[model samples]
Target: MDLFTLTVVNAFIALVATGVLAMQGQADRQFRYQRYFLLAGGCMLLNAGISAIHFSGILLPYWLIPALTNSLSVGASLALAAGIHRHLQKPGKRFGLLLVFILLFVLHLTEFARSDINHRFLISIPVVLLLNLWCISMLWQHRKTELGKVYLAFIATFAFNILQFVFRTTFMVLEQHQIIQTSIAPVVHNVGFFALTAFAILVFCCIILLSHSQQRQMLQQLSERDALTGLLNRRTLELRLNAEFSRCQRNNSTLCLLLLDADYFKQINDKLGHATGDLAVQHIAKIADQQLRDYDLLFRYGGEEFLLCLPDTDLPAALQIAERLRLAINSAPLFTPQPYFLTVSIGVASSKDSQSWQTLLQQADQALYLAKHQGRNQVQSYQPTAAVSR
Candidate 1:
């Protein structure tokens, strides 16, 4: 299509990207990277609009026309670079943004505003190249994530953008010096126009795809984690337990499971409030986590109940660890509005020859029931009454 049509299309695409990113940022408030992406999209839309206006036959005011339009181009590039930096949780360099804008304004005032419209691209080329290169570096630094290939693709796209500007700048210089007198400049111009349009679309698509991937990761975490305590929820606990059990069987190694319940959790909720009860639950979970080994897996089995798996531990050692956990939670003071001590009753179950996950969980539950029945705030070990078939 013609340049005018292509300009309008770019503007439309940018505006749509802005709206979509804004909505995504609104929906996922914690992922602050989305806000940066939304800002980048807005700048892109503004840049495209400025480009379209500049292409029209109407004359704009001296200081407000090409200067602002080119500034927006710089803004679009800088915003994407900033968004990538934020996405990686890097420390901010707010002054760098101000410095860039100041430099761009200086160029606009002296060189760009006074020169022919054709020269503005020459001024913009280096700025765009540096910003795109910065973005590529950020993406490359973080290329080892779960979406490593996606990050690499983004880097490759930005690298191509950098090359486009590099070649464009070189051609502009060659033409200015009358290096090769021919109509080749127009051909390069047309190619550059299409390349810029395609690059804009690709950049927005990458941003959206990256946002979707991050959202999926966040949702997966939410599904598997307890919202209050941040421990693995029951939904994930079974899968983890099964995997650990199979691993232990194949390795012929010992493994232990501990089922822990906050003592008198319902009474705490009834006496205090659900909020305080939540605090109590969190306190117990924290204490339990502190007492357990780093490799051990902890899960919120149910309300006020946590499950822990310990690999390479025999029944005696598991009981000792369980007792230590029980003591730690019982001794720790939960300084709430109504300050009180928290306690957990933990039931220990160790792996046996040809034992299944179901049997281990059942044994732990029964042991926990016995611990609570005998008295709360203690640890009990599961002792099978009989040896049956697997």
Candidate 2:
């Protein structure tokens, strides 16, 4: 097609690639393989960008055009091939395949150095065909798996590239033979190539949307979750608490925040070092996680401090839970090689009347502070209207 049309198509493909990369953020290892496919497809389209200049002010040579375009296409093909092997769970072969592609690239460049365009095309197309065949083979071998879906996706991708290659080759051969004004040019190649690019662009767009959707999901998960403990962070707790509070107010359901702090944490760090201390916290978090309901949100408020937002729970019930957790921590031995014992202090705060999530947190903190002041391993519950907001 014309340069303007080609440039627009390539630009569109580039955007699709970006979208695909973004979406891969939360994908499992297998599904994430599609990222490479879109990446390769994007690279191939970039080659068209060199010739499809919209600016009339710029000039480019015919020889430079085909050569650069061919390079990008080959490069893209190689990336896709490597991605296929990864999806197929044959990663050991990827390095070898990559090396082979590098050699082919070297051979193609050498042919170019010698001004042999035919040999360059000859060397490149077979590599692409082989790459696609390998992908198809991998898919066929794993036809019974959930991974089959990935293979089918690859098949569609391979067909698109093969079709694009055929159309491009036809036009190049015809143009080189001085057949520009022939009816076959418009009917068989020009319009046909444009249509194929459009089809390929659509395929690319689908992949991009898939990837972009994943990235957004991953970001959302990261926002609400603590990386180490797999618990809701402080920000997420506030949001969940607000929503829970509104629901509780409407239904007259009770809710509470249980604040827990590990006792003698600094001593653990000083004696066992930070690594063991981290493991201790991790162990306690695991124990706490096992004890909590799925609806409950746990937050690491800061160093050695955790908060649990309990919906539909009254102050008495919250205190019972706090006591249970306190006993659980105190009874459990240190889950490390170093000889030691660890305990935790827990504070429970229930809403007296209407209160914000912040007010509940302040009350819980006050109770926890009291526990620390009294001793180490103990559970303290805040009576309604017992103290002013700290």
Candidate 3:
């Protein structure tokens, strides 16, 4: 296609992308990255519009067109980088990136207008190259996750764009040296230009896919998590316990279970109101989370109660962990409407003594009962003969 046609096509695509992304952002407020996507689309639209007007022999100042177009291109690139960061759930410093882009665009715009097309390409190259490289690095860091796998498309696209820029630079140099005498030597005539357009379309599709994936994840979390504490709910606990139980039995590996309940939780709810009571429950979940190892699984079994699954742990080790959890809860006072101290009674049971997870849970519950009976804020272990309070 000719330059005018390509520019118009690009402008149409950019406008379409902007509309799609804006609608997506409106539909799903959780994926804030869609806003950056919209920003990128808008910038690309502006860039294409300005390019078309300049190419149409409009009576604008010769320098002004390329300057605005290139600045918008830089803005689009930076917005893409910011979008990728937010998509990965990473902290994106948009203000800092915007500041840097503004400085670089100002520095490049004047010189870019005065210089030839090759110099303009050179000036724009580093800005885009650096931004694309930054995005590639961010995606690479999260390569192990499911979302990261989707990011590979982004990597390929950016890398292709960067490689295309490199080739365009070389072609520009050859043209400058009069090594090749061809009319179609500019970037608009290159194969890479079309490829970049195709990749831009692919990126929009990928962002839609990313949003779908995140939405599915959110739904899964809602189904499996406790609404108040944001810990695994009882349904999730049952599934995990069954899986862990089978695995332990097959491998002859030890596993431990602990059932913990917040002491005087009902009293707190009655005296301090449900709002403070909710905070107290959240506090227990937080403390328990901090005390456990990465391999340990913590679940909110029900209201004011939690269940923990510790793989490869024996009775003695489980007891120690339970005691540590109890003490940790006792040490930190929860911030309610008023400061209030909280305690938890924990029960420990090991897979070595029980044939099945149900048996283990039953034993743990019994031990938990004993701990609550023998004054709260204690860890108790299950004995086959009787519950032993520790």
Please provide the root mean square deviation of candidate 1 (C-alpha atoms, Å): 4.2
Write model 3 residue lDDT over 301-330, tens digit each, in one string: 878999999998888998999998898999
Per-model TM-score, in order, reads 0.79, 0.51, 0.90
Better of 2 and 3 by lDDT: 3
Which parts of model 3 are misplaced by more than 4 Å?
89-92, 109-113, 181-190, 247-252, 335-339, 387-390
lDDT of each: 0.81, 0.71, 0.84
Candidate 2 structure quality by residue, lDDT tens digits, 264-301: 89998997899887888787888898789988878888
Where's the lowest-lDDT run of ten residues in candidate 3? 186-195
Off by over 4 Å in 1: 1-5, 22-31, 59-66, 93-96, 111-127, 141-153, 177-181, 248-254, 266-275, 289-295, 311-324, 352-354, 366-390
For residue 128, give model 2's deviation from the true position in Å.
Answer: 24
lDDT score, candidate 2, position 49 = 62
Q: Name the lDDT of candidate 1.
A: 0.81
Writing each residue's lDDT as its tens digit, candidate 1 over 20-77 gives: 8888788878877676667777877887786777677556665556777677778878
Best by TM-score: 3
Better of 2 and 3 by TM-score: 3
Question: How many collisions between residues are there in candidate 3?
Answer: 0
